[model samples]
Target chain A: QQQVKQSPQSLIVQKGGISIINCAYENTAFDYFPWYQQFPGKGPALLIAIRPDVSEKKEGRFTISFNKSAKQFSLHIMDSQPGDSATYFCAPYRDNAGNMLTFGGGTRLMVKP
Target chain B: NAGVTQTPKFRVLKTGQSMTLLCAQDMNHEYMYWYRQDPGMGLRLIHYSVGEGTTAKGEVPDGYNVSRLKKQNFLLGLESAAPSQTSVYFCASRSNREGQGALGRANVLTFGAGSRLTVL
Candidate 1:
């Protein structure tokens, strides 16, 4: 069974627009939630992350809005740029689980110049 | 510094052939992992090691084996390659001594450039 689900397999937005990707997880065992960004020919990298205790966490133009009660989290990219066009994944992890992460179906984002 | 490095960035193999993908980390981390990424499927863990001389199966460990002979090296081996195994494999590592705070970056994973394997 898919423990995590992500919406909008693909997305396209203007350079100045906002790009949002949402994810829902079913595992209550998860505590640390992180989002990863992947560029073609490269491996996924850490973008930003949030814990269940916080409702939101932002880093520069990237923000992670989390809803612990809803078991949902979303990534918001403000002023999306062409350079930000890439695949994004939401990986929920449990610390005691040896930090093993369960990834969601990836969202391919494309920002037009 | 090379945080994490994967060897043979690209390879092609025939069914039933055996091969090994090597992962090396210079971060002195105590944990290492192997994950496979497929189109629209995100990333799936194949196996992982928490420390040298110890390995554990992950969500999709079948048809794959892993060994952590040294603190800086983790090796993933395929006894018999299959077409279904064709995918981009990633190696990631994190320090086990990271901060214990719930919101700490201990869960952060630093990944390598990845190895693309094609089985015919």
Candidate 2:
């Protein structure tokens, strides 16, 4: 079963525009949500994360909005730049087993200059 | 610290062949993971290790075997190469912790560059 589902296989946005990616999960046991950014030929790095206890969490230009009832979460990037172009993955953590993570399909975002 | 690293950045294998992918982490992490990435399937967990000498199956563990002989090393072996197993593989490690803001909560996964395998 696919625990987490992400939409928009690929996306393009103009520079300085807002970029949004959505994700949904079926497992309600997950409490922690995190987003990762990956560049070509490199590993993915932590971008932003949020706990279900909070409705939203923002860090600089990156924001993660969570809806516990809907079992969905989203990542929004404000004032996106070309440098922000990369693959983004949304992952949820299940506490049942050694804090294992369930990752989404992933979304590739491209910011046009 | 080198964090997490994988050997054989790129490899080509023939059907029925056998090979092993090595992953090493120097951070003394308690949790280790192996994931495979495909075009649209995203990253699927093949196997994982909670600690040294412990291994567990994940989402797609078929035709794959893993070993965590040493705390710093994790190995993934394919007994018989198949075209379906051709994909990019990643290794991750995280420290152990408890409660909120703990050391490792699955939010931060230090991954390697990834090993690209091709089976023909």
Candidate 3:
């Protein structure tokens, strides 16, 4: 995809471990970077979001770290548990005339208890 | 609040068949989008509507078409389904009620549960 490049197609983590997924984009016009979480047979839901102006944003146990100059952003999940196992995707949005979203391939994370 | 609802949770179609996916939102969002999710390819945009009576192509709009006759409804139609078109379809809506209005950082997207379709 020409939009964003995501890493680690699949990841396995022990209970209470940390899960990390990284995504990089080439479009400087992208202003909103958000991560979506999807469980089996479910639609992807917004997990966290960040604006280009902020370097990092943390909510609950999820944190989004953005590097504007590097055009990269990553999602970090702390104290990951089995219930946290799900697929994560990085989608960046550009609000020009309308909202245009480009998503990464996705990362499937399995947290084993 | 029934943020977004997609009809037909699952469907199976033979090659050359046709189907339509419906997405309805109660949030009164101005922007609605249809995306197909395939393995490895992730989620690819099929079509989008900025507002009622407006539709635009996305990255993978070649195999699909869309219509937004009402502010809360967006419809996706597959004229002739192909085997390669088998994938999970998602509908999303965002209220552009954030930031400078034109370019807002708070454009939050709410996604539908999803509609699974198979074209064999």
Candidate 4:
């Protein structure tokens, strides 16, 4: 069973357009929600994250809108650029002694020039 | 600053072969993790360590073992490689220091380049 589910396995967007990816998680105990971006030949890097307390969080063109009651969250990229093309993953974090992240399947995004 | 570093970026092995993948972090993080990325399966944790000399299993720990002998190092070992084990492995580390930096949720996870292993 998938605790965290992400949709749109792949996406295509034009430069300066808006791109969106959605995810839904079943674990209410998740302490934090973070998104990761990965390019070929490189490891995933933290993009942006949000706490369940907040309805939304935005950083530059990357925005994370979270709905606590619905158990859903989505990432929106405004003015998407070609450089933004990469794989995005939604990860819900858990902590024991240290933080552990559980990732969704993944969404590959392509920004067309 | 070499946030996280993985050694033997790529490796190939046959069934029954044994090898170890090394992970090192310079951020002085207390938590280190080993995860495998398989197509369509996302990234699944294999094992993890909270501090030096401690190790614990994750979702997929059947064919792997891990050890954290030093504060900055975590090692994942495959006792007997199988074709099913072929995938990209990632090592990551994180500190508890949050609510700092530009993002309120600071001290986030830092990942290595990755180690790609192929088993035949």
> Among these predicted structures, which one has the highest DockQ?
1
**What's model 4's overall lDDT?**
0.87
lDDT of 4 by residue, A62-96 (tens): 99998988999999999999999999999876533
- Measured against the true two-chain complex, the DockQ scores of the candidates, in the order shown, are 0.58, 0.49, 0.47, 0.54
Candidate 1 lDDT tens digits, A76-108:
999999999999999887754565566888999
Better of 1 and 4 by lDDT: 1
lDDT of 4 by residue, B21-109 (tens): 99999989988989999876778888888889988888899989999999999999999999999999999998865544334475577
Candidate 2 displacement at residue B107 in angstroms: 5.7
The CAPRI-style docking tier of model 2 reads: acceptable
Candidate 2 lDDT, tens digit per residue, B1-120? 788999989999999999999999998888899999988778889999988999988999999999999999999999999999999999987766543543234426789999999999
Model 2's lDDT to the true fold?
0.87
CAPRI grade of model 1: medium
Q: Each candidate: RMSD to true structure?
A: 1.8, 2.1, 2.4, 2.1
> What's the interface RMS deviation of candidate 3?
3.3
Best by lDDT: 1
User: Over the stretch B1-120, how does candidate 1's per-residue lDDT look in tens digits?
Assistant: 989999989999999999999999999988899999988788898998989999988889999999999999999999999999999999999877644665547557889999999999
Poorly placed runs, candidate 2 (over 4 Å): A95-100, B102-107
Residue A54 lDDT, candidate 3, scale 0-100: 73
